[model samples]
Target: MLISVQALRALAAWVVVCHHFMQIFFDFHATGPIGQFFTDKGAVGVDIFFVISGLVIYLSTQNKDMPAGRFMVNRIIRIVPAYWLYTAAMGLLILVAQPLMPHAAIDWTHFILSLLFIPSENPGGYGMYPTLNVGWTLNYEMLFYLLFSLVFLFEQRHRPLIVAAALFAVSEVLTRLGVISHFYRNDIVYEFLLGIAIGVFHRRGWIANGLWLPLLAIVGGLLTIYHLAPSDRLLHWGLPSAVIVLACVSLEPYFQGNRLLKVLGDCSYSVYLLHVLVLYGGWLAATRYGLNPYAVFAVCVPLIALGGWCSYQWIEKGLYLRLKDWLDKRRNDGELKALSRQEY
Candidate 1:
């Protein structure tokens, strides 16, 4: 089960990596079929991520003593350090090499918002992008974490139900109010609910174990998505994304995980965060050497993967462990002091 989820995490991260590379390297409407295909598939990856997130959260927190504040703090500690590091790196790059990335600029407000995981209009003329363009999704993720934290108030068994009901209610109300949040309103958010549903099914053993059935669902859902237009993205992409996630979770026990894919999955956050920088730098280097798009592709992915791995080891894993240990010790010490005072 863990392997399948990890593999999906790897898959989702790379899909987005390829998707952005195609978009950034070429025009918005790609002249070629491959570009357009990747672009279409890439968007689905994000939707898949949302679904997976909900599923993971439910699965992890179920029957666990995770307080709302603790949940938020853990999420913050896990996400913010690496994100801020990368964002600062990006800011430094913009300061030094403004000519390389024409659209990218040092808009202080945007940079601050990016660090805070607040969505803002990009100074680069990109719509509602944070300083690190990919961090836009992090903004949504932060919001989701916040909302999910509230469910901690409920009992373990009841939390999943609250998640589904609360998310659905909020989504429906936002839809009715015509609230204009490109970040978290409407159907996109429901992808998480789809994930929560999958988690419930998996936890309850309701899903039949198998390869063929889940594989078929994935293939069929993707095929349906391939034919549809990108409009009403939730229906077109989100539904299929959920279907894919559900299938993946269903196949968890049966599927033997690939080592490389699992490694990538372990570094999935780093992959998603750092790939853009690799792509950007690769583009500049490729052009400098008169390397073609294929060469650029060849070089970019390996570097991105390598960089993500390194970043994961050092910043994400290393820093995270240190912070978590320190936090745990502080908590333990505080508890001891309180106990001692009560004894007195």
Candidate 2:
């Protein structure tokens, strides 16, 4: 049985929620250890999410005969449907709540850019616009998917690793040379490449024995914390992120059964997609009711988790599985037809 990477995904989502909560409630510019820490670390969750995405995607494709079209279709089906639903829901919510929150204006241009998964050129903003901050990561993810698909389409399996590595190197060099803006050249592709490397290692049985693996993971985590720049924290942590990933995959079955963790993992994607709304909504409710931030989290976390679970059960799982099954069947049928035609 494969280890569930859901736990890592869930953890990353919660971390981001916590980071956002701190940002919204606490004064990050305040003079204190806690304030400084929160300010410095708010984006760590995003990094974790990137690493996890890379690892999961790599694992999904390992040892599988995934054609380019099939791979692209599978990825789009997994991500786009839920993302579009959330985007529409958030867009509508923003519209309805705009009267109450006068600052919640929609920029049609930015909204269109977001729909295309393109990062907006608007300065000092998370995405093309500021409607939803979490949407920026989705933009990066979509870009990575497009690039990954293109590479898979034209390059043979043997060449993909080199091509991906070269792409990463070029992007990095461009960023360092100031040819590309830091915002545009941020190191996400490298993280994805690191994930692919981990997948390759797993396939080659090069991952070391139990204790050494965890130890390396711990070291990688430390390196991530130390070497990660404020803007590139998440990207820097990719290796450590992979180490943690390997550890989890190695240890998942031995844990036998932690129903709670497993359940959280199962609802992880929903948690990630919905937590921003929960955090924002919780903050608004708390402010209106004069509740403490920690108190807000207390109520919000469980409610968000429950919401995530419901979304997973009612939306993501149903749609993803059905779509995947339909695609697989279609692929199989096409293959059979081709074979029959050749025989005739």
Candidate 3:
């Protein structure tokens, strides 16, 4: 994996965290120009994530012929364990702290769906969100994985084109039929296609090497995103995200990953999952003291990052290693059984 991508992942998680921080500390609807920019646009981090997901997944499997089952297993191991643990933990927190924290009414159906990463309308009429609201992105991630896995059934050299064609056909048909509004059918899926395109370009040595070109793309993309109204569709966010990603990967030769960025990237998933709780807790404490908003932000952002790092070490990495060991043991046991049968 490209080291820069990991750093980018950490940057994306923090952007979302900062956006939520703005919401918790101020009148969310009444932000000034700069504050409004962060609040309105911070969620674009999700767009960046989708693009990265496409690029990374495609690149990871582009040259190697992987079994669909193995692909699914690796993806599940990376995503499910940490997500379910956090979902359950947060649910318990909501139940215990109901009076102290404002939470949506628990709908058992949606709760179950959220646990399974199924797309469903949030129980409390908050639109299409899971019990752990940020997990709506995971639903998309899982869906993308499922869709991308289909390409593995085909030849390795052709998988990229096959996946792109399948996505294009599906996205176009779904949009034309007016089914795109459904949670599962949203056009946002196309953003992954954009990422796949970039991955293919990079793999084929088609990306331009000139530094000026990427810089121009990056600047132009930002300007477009800046001018976009809050309600714009996938193109508004996805295109700029694609541009930024394209530029980053093209200029990868000039980039070097430092310890701080590497750490953040390693913990990016933990950071994304845990930041909400940390920031909310900080909000509760800071509000009681009538602290300056800026001071509250200054204190809370670092706390959130620290919380994420600790969680990564204690929770995410620990569980992941344990799960991997168990899976490995199971595979070894099966191999031994097969060997014994053959010897007999």
TM-score for each model: 0.93, 0.81, 0.90
lDDT string for model 3 (1-344, tens) is 66667777888888898788787677466458877877888888888888888999988885677678778887898888778877877677667666766645566787898998877787667688887778999988887787788887887777767776776665666646866535755667778888888888988899876688888988998888888954655789888989888887877766665677678888888888877777666776677787777777788778877878887887777776788789889988998999999999
Q: Give the TM-score (vs. native) of candidate 3.
A: 0.90
The deviation in Å at residue 321 for candidate 3 is: 3.1
Error of 2 at 277 (Å): 0.8
What Cα-based lDDT does every candidate model obtain? 0.81, 0.67, 0.79
TM-score-better candidate, 2 vs 3: 3
Model 2 C-alpha lDDT per residue in residues 1-344, reported as the tens digit of each score: 23345666677677776666676666345356655655666566666667667666766655566566767777788777777777777678777666655545566786676676766654333334434657778766765666666555443466446547655755677657876445547665567666666667766777644655675776777567655665554445656676677776665555456677777777777777777777767767787889887788788889888998988877787888998899789878999999999999
Compared with the true structure, model 1 gives a TM-score of 0.93
- Model 3, stretches more than 4 Å misplaced? 100-103, 165-181, 230-232
Better of 2 and 3 by lDDT: 3
Off by over 4 Å in 2: 1-4, 27-38, 99-103, 121-130, 151-166, 169-183, 212-216, 219-228, 231-236, 247-253, 256-259, 327-344
| List of clashing residue pairs for candidate 1 | none
lDDT of 2: 0.67
Q: Give me the candidate number with maximum lDDT.
A: 1
Write one digit per residue (lDDT tens) for candidate 1, span 102-156.
Answer: 8888778888988988766888786888878888777767877888898878777
